[model samples]
Target: SQQGEEDPQALSIQEGENATMNCSYKTSINNLQWYRQNSGRGLVHLILIRSNEREKHSGRLRVTLDTSKKSSSLLITASRAADTASYFCATYNTDKLIFGTGTRLQVFP
Candidate 1:
């Protein structure tokens, strides 16, 4: 299975603080991508880090991949209320993607 599991089903943080989430997958993947969803809307791609990459950064977001452990983590620095959303980690195969349940992040002002 290409399923990825994310910890802390939910998280609550104050504005300007940082939030971190972790994910673990079962099978091998070509790449892993992070996505964000506001409310019940569609997911928006955040970042894509290949299997060979150890770490990647996009603006305030930083991602680390550990192929040995088959896991990854995402960190959002200096977050804001606008960052309140559901974050998901998706494992990509040749044909499709398998998404984690997601971590619902609530940023309070």
Candidate 2:
């Protein structure tokens, strides 16, 4: 599949902890993007890593892409209770995006 799928589809962590998510795709991609969705809410874009970039960081989020391996990973450092949300990895393909199933994250206070 051209879609990027996240591993360990579900996660639960305590506040101030770190959460890591990984994605694997079947084909090459121009770029990879991470998104967050609150319960019953639309998704919010988090970060994007181009094929040429080995790693990128924004705020508490870090993303790494390994084009050779057809995989990527996302790490959210020092997660907070507010970070409770569903996270998705998407790949850009031919002017459109194909989103994977997603990872459900639950953060407890």
Candidate 3:
């Protein structure tokens, strides 16, 4: 199974600001997804964008996929204190889910 790697291992911002995370993969994938994890807790799926899709959004989350570049990006709009978490990007390779290293986002109020 291949793995996606997120850039800038960590991020910090204040409440009301936005956070952006980028991911790069080594191979083609079926779908790309984003997840958020708080500290040591489990991850919560944020959004999923298929390879054929250019962009998708849910609430404050905006995801964009670029097949040519084998990359994707996640953006959180108007972030809040509760948005603080570790963000990850994942892709489906064959029968497995390959996850990125993750970006730790700290939202300070």
Flag regions of model 3 displaced more than 4 Å. Answer: none
Report each candidate's C-alpha RMSD, comma-separated, in the order given.
1.2, 1.2, 1.1
Residue 106 in candidate 1 has what lDDT? Answer: 99
Q: Candidate 2's residue-wise lDDT over 1-109, tens digit each? A: 5487888799999999999999998777888899999999999999989889999999999999998899999999999999999999998778889998889999999
Q: What is the lDDT of residue 30 in candidate 2?
A: 81
Q: What is the TM-score of each candidate against the true structure?
A: 0.95, 0.95, 0.96
Clash statistics: count for each candidate: 0, 0, 0
73: Cα error in model 1, Å: 0.3
Q: How accurate is candidate 3 locally (lDDT)?
A: 0.90
Q: Write the per-residue lDDT of candidate 1 for residues 1-109, one digit (tens) a residue.
A: 5388898899999999999999999888889999999997999999999998999999999999999999999999999999999999999766789899889999999
Best by lDDT: 1
lDDT tens digits by residue: candidate 3, 1-109 = 4398897799999999989999999888889999889998999988999989999989888999999999999999999999988999998778888889999999999
Worst-scoring 10-residue span by lDDT in model 1: 1-10
Q: What is the model-wide C-alpha lDDT for candidate 1? A: 0.94
Which residue pairs overlap in candidate 3's backbone?
Answer: none
Q: Roughly what TM-score does model 2 have, to 2 decimal places?
A: 0.95
